[model samples]
Target: MRTTILLLLAVLPLTLMAQRWHITGFGGLSNYQGDLQEKRITTNQANGAFGLGVQYDLNPKLSLRGGLVYGKLSGDDKKNTDSFLVARNLNFTSPLLEGHILAEYRFFDLDNYRFTPYVFAGLGIFGFEPYTFDTTGQKYYLQPLGTEGQGLSIYPDRKPYKRVQVALPFGAGLKFRLNEMVTLGYEIGWRKTFTDYIDDVSTTYVDPAALLAERGPKAVELSYRGGELKDGNPNYPADGTVRGGSKVKDWYYFQGITVGVRLGSGSGPFSGGGGGKRSRQTDCPRNVF
Candidate 1:
């Protein structure tokens, strides 16, 4: 991490010297697509998101940006039309914080055109902790409970997943330059994640007696919530019965407006040292005047 930071510091000045710098801010909504979600994408549980970033226009066609974003995501099986899902009765909410760096390609030049459509792809590292409220309205974090039998000695194959994971972000948007100093745009971006546990429901059911004894009753209660629904099946599934998808991973998306403020001259000599003749004034200028 130290080496990476030093390298970025070394390269930033060079990038700034040759390119236009824009400090950007983002406001948008974020939503997730996971095992509990009824569809791939929807605004049902979308939450507000905010971000701040710095963009460098490398040239007319390419640019680079890095930013930090904060967003909230959630999923609930109760919202689904599928009967099996509604019976699952699982729900979760997580606050996601991410840092990303991306390379953007613009289809048109901003110098001559007022607007341009651009696409971007990048990598990100994000941290999240899924949690939900119990029937008594108490909040319980899902991970440490070993709801899916994770972290239990007997379930050697099921280990606790990391809270911090990586993601691949790619999307397209349109940008409109409002003036010489300000630019406005909107974008919709998707993050393909590596883990299926973002919603805290993955894999098969664990023995209720084992979960109750090892992690306590709350663990078992939150894990299998089917009984909580009205006239819902109260019997717990067998130890190996499927509780959630074991194969498919999860995804999240962000869509919003962006505001950018341009910094420095668009076309100017390098801010860093450049070879140029220095100007000098004549000493006799006062006498001549």
Candidate 2:
């Protein structure tokens, strides 16, 4: 991390010298798509997200940007309109945090053309912890419980998923120059994540008896919410029953407006950018006539 920071600083002068440095801040709604609510773009569960970034334009059409973003993502079958989903009654909310380095390609130059549409793709590392509340409103973190049989010696096929994972972020946006020193943009980005456990509902249901023995009653309660739905028994699905679609992965989205400031030039010639030729001052005596 230290090396990376030093490298960025070293590159800053080069970026600004070329009249291509920009610092930006973005904030807006974020949403998730997974087993809970497949194919829905509705904002019923939207959460807040914000980010700060720096960009270096390599040319009128291409640039490189690095930034950090944070947001909250949640999914609740109880909050879903689908009757079958609401009956499933499973839910989880997790904080989303990541740092990304992306390459952007623009259709035009906002600096000179006034407006531009662009696309970006990048890699990121994100951390998340999924949790939910019990009937008495007691909150429980689901990871250590081995829900869906994760980390259980008996369930050889199910392995524990990590709290931090890799993400692929790609999307498009439009930018408008607010002035020579500032720019405004709006973008919609999607993150394809490797872990399906972001919501802690992947794989099949585990045996209640075994789950209870290993992780306690709290695990059993969280592993299966439908048991208390309308029936006294939670064993209807039995073990190895489908609790979540493991075949499909999970994804999250970020869309928001950005405000950015151009850096360097106005500060001073010694600050970095090309100084060009220093023209000689005119003779003062001639102006007195």
> Where is model 2 poorest over a 10-residue stretch in terms of lDDT?
277-286
How many clashes (backbone atoms < 3 Å, residues ≥3 apart in a chain or on different chains) does model 2 have?
1
Residue lDDT tens for model 2, 133-221: 99999988889888888877788878888999999999999888665677788999999999888889777887888888878889888
TM-score of each: 0.86, 0.84
Kindly give the number of clashing pairs for every candidate. 0, 1
For lDDT, the strongest prediction is 1
Shift in Å, residue 156, candidate 2: 2.0
Across 133-167, the per-residue lDDT of candidate 1 in tens digits comes to 99989999999999999988889889999999999
As for candidate 1, its clashing pairs are none
Give the TM-score comparing model 2 with the true structure, all chains together.
0.84
Error of 1 at 256 (Å): 0.7
